[model samples]
Target: MTYALIAFALVLAVGVALLYNKLVRLRRAVENAFAQIDVQLQRRHDLIPNLVETAKAYLAHEQATFEGVARARSQAQIARSEASPTDAPSMRALAQAESGLGAALGRLMAVSEAHPTLQADAQMAALHEELASTENRIAFSRQAYNDSVTRYDVSVESVPGVFVAGPLGFKPAESLLEAPPEAAVAPRVAFA
Candidate 1:
């Protein structure tokens, strides 16, 4: 009877240790994923000044639009700096700031479209391409972060995990980024 009890205790100890280690791994992964997103967002912010400068000459008439873009970019940078990947309210604020920046960029792009010379400028073209690529990378990073969060959240919420995770203080994480609404709609083509 003594040996049986000891064996049961050992097995339980091992199980608890494994569960603890697994939780730790998931938490680290979530942190790492968020770090990647932060890097991409910083890269995008760095590129914004160059993008605006490249378009400035052609957009000289649209000073107010430029100001709006500049303001939005500043707000986004501040928001991004304040946000942590795992915190929902901070992430939401960052997202809102980013959305404002996106709208400003869209207006800037529209202004560019009006100027054939601006569109044709080699430097402007390259800047546009680079900005587009950075946006794509941001999208990819957001997806990866969301994927990691989903996995961690699931592990923390599921049957056995629920009991272990709560006691361990593994709170659920929120996804900060999402595809823009326009991305869900199919493009319309008109042939003249």
Candidate 2:
């Protein structure tokens, strides 16, 4: 009876240890994924000022558009700084801020389209291309982050993991896949 009890405890200990190690790895992956998103978001934010400055020369009358973009960009930066994949509210805030910035940029692009001179400028063209590329990278990073979060969350919520996760402080992370209502439909920006 003593040997059987000892063997049972040994097996349970090993199983719990394995589960703990797996959770740790998944959590680390979630953090790494969010870091990638943060890097891309920083790049996007850095490019916005140059884009606005280049467009400013020809779109003098479009001050409102420029101001809107600036405001949205500032909000996004703040949200990005505070965001964590483990915190659902912070993640939601970041997504909302990013959506607002995208809408604002779209408006600026639409207004700039009216001025042929702006479209024809070499500097503006280059900046627009860079911004588009950055946007694509951000999209890819978000998708990757969401994937990581999904894996982590599932593990935290699953059977044996659920038994160990809460005791070990392994909370489920939030995914970046959910967009606000305003972002449900993409803004229309046509380039000729």
Candidate 3:
């Protein structure tokens, strides 16, 4: 009976250790995903200055639009800095700021199209291309983040993982992607 008890205890200890390791890996994956998102977001934020410069000369009357983008971008930077993985509220705040910045940037892009000279300018053209590429990268980052969250969520919900994760306060991450407003929809198709 004593030997049997020891064997059972050993198996239980090993099982708990494996579960703990799985939880740690899932947590790290979530952290890594956030870092990936931060990288793309930072790249996108850095592109704003060039976009603003490209629009400046031709958008002299659109000062408010430019300022809106700048202000929103600043808020996003602050929010991103505040997003600690353990703080759900801060993460939500960061997501909200990012969404606002996206809307403001969209408006700036729309205003740029009104200026034929700006559209034709070589520097502005290059900036425009860069902005498009940055946007694409942001989209990819969001997808990656979502995928990571899904895996983490699955791990946390699984049998042994759940037993360990619950005690450690592990929860699924909120997705960073925001849905587009239908009423303010940007045209998907451009016509010549």
Candidate 4:
């Protein structure tokens, strides 16, 4: 009877240790994913000023648009600094800031479109292309981050993990991409 009890305890101990190790790995993966997003976001932020400067000469009269983009970019930088995959509010703030920046950039682009010279400027075109490429990288990073968070959260919340996670201080992670309410509805397609 004593040997049987010892063997049972040994198996349980090994199982829990394995579960703990898995959780640790998942948590590390989530952190690594967020770091990739941070790097891409930093690249996007760095590209913004060059883009703005290239457009400035042509957009001298569009002061409001320039200010809006600068302000949005500042807010996004702050939010990105404070954001973490472990913190939901910070992640949400980062998303909101990024959205605001995108809108501001869109407005700037629309305004710039009115200036044929700006559109034709080779420097401006190059900057815009680089910015677009950075945006694509950011999107890809966000998707990767979200996938990591999902995997971590699932492990933390499921099965025997549920019993061990809390005791081991493993908390669920927040995804970097939270779809806005508008995203739930399909877009209308019309042929005019």
Candidate 5:
């Protein structure tokens, strides 16, 4: 009877060890995912300067728009400096700044459309393409980061993990990526 009790204890210990290792691996993956987002966001930030310079060369009248972009760039720098993304107020400001930059960039692009010479400039066109590609990469990286966070959040919240997570101060990770406010509130159309 005593041997049977020892066997049961051994099995429980092994199961716990395996679960702990899995949890650690999952947490590491979440960190790696955030790092990837940081790298891509940094790349996006780099592209913004080139794009802004190109716009500046042509859109001399739009100094205010340029300043908005510059300010957004600054806010983004502060936000990314943290080990984790900030909560609502800072996040909202960052989002608003990014949206302003996008609007300014769109207006800058429209200027290029109006000025045939500007659109035809090889360097400007190339920089615009690189900026667009960088934006896509940033979007993808954020998605991946959120996915990893989701997995980690669930793992920490569920069954056996709940037992360990509470005592260890492990809690659900904040989702850094979310649909822009415009996207969330946009009117939807349905097809038959």
Candidate 6:
């Protein structure tokens, strides 16, 4: 009877240790995923200046648009640096800042469309292509981050983990950046 009790306690100890380690591993994965997002966001921010300068060369009359882009970019940089991707409030602020930057970029692109010369410029075309590619990468990174967060949250809230997580103070992580509502709906296309 004594040996049976000892064996049961030992098994329980091992189980708890394993679960704790698994929780820690999941938390680390979430952090790494968010780091990937940070890398892509930095790449996008770096490209913005070059893109803006290229547009400036041709759209000399549109000073205000450029200023707006600059301001938005600056705000985004601040938000990106100040906020952790796993924190809800900080992530929301970062998303808002990024949306503002996207809006500025869209306006610049629209205005550039009116200038045939700018459209024809090879440099502008190349910058636009790079920007598009970077946007795709950012999207992928965000998806990965969200997936990691989901997995981590599930582990924290499920089964034996539920018993361990609360005492360990393991809270669910926030999802990655979400698309702004204005950008969520597909634009209607009429072939007329």
Q: By lDDT, is 1 or 5 better?
A: 1
lDDT measured at residue 119 in model 5 versus the true structure, 0 to 100: 87
What digit string (tens of lDDT, one per residue) describes model 3 on residues 39-106? 88898899898889778878788788889999999999999998865566887888788888888887
Candidate 4 segments exceeding 4 Å error = 178-192
List, residue by residue over 1-192, the lDDT tens digit for candidate 6. Answer: 999999999999999999999999999999999898899889989988988898899988889889988999999999999877457888888888988888787777777777889999998899889888988998898899899999999999999899998898788888866767885443332223
How many residue pairs clash per model? 0, 0, 0, 0, 0, 0
Backbone clash pairs in model 5 (N, Cα, C under 3 Å; residues 3+ apart or in different chains), count: 0
Q: Number of clashing pairs, model 2?
A: 0
Candidate 4 collision pairs: none
Candidate closest to the true structure, highest TM-score: 2
lDDT of prediction 1: 0.82
Q: What is the lDDT of residue 61 in candidate 1?
A: 70
Q: What TM-score would every model get versus the actual structure?
A: 0.88, 0.94, 0.89, 0.92, 0.80, 0.90
Q: Give every collision pair in model 3.
A: none
Tens digits of per-residue lDDT for model 4 on 21-110? 999999999999999989988998898888888889887877787898999999999999999888889999999888878877877777
How accurate locally, in lDDT, is each candidate?
0.82, 0.89, 0.81, 0.86, 0.71, 0.86
Task: Estimate, for each residue in 63-181, the C-alpha lDDT of model 1 and write its tens digit.
Answer: 88789989999999999889876688998988888878887887777778677899999988887888899889888888888899898889889977888899888888888767367
The predicted structure with the larger lDDT, 1 or 6, is 6
Q: Considering every candidate listed, which one attains the maximal lDDT?
A: 2
Q: Is candidate 4 or candidate 6 better by TM-score?
A: 4
Q: What order do candidates take by TM-score, descending? A: 2, 4, 6, 3, 1, 5
lDDT ranking from best candidate downward: 2, 4, 6, 1, 3, 5
TM-score of 2: 0.94
Tens digits of per-residue lDDT for model 5, 33-84: 8788778778767777887788778878768767877877776777666446
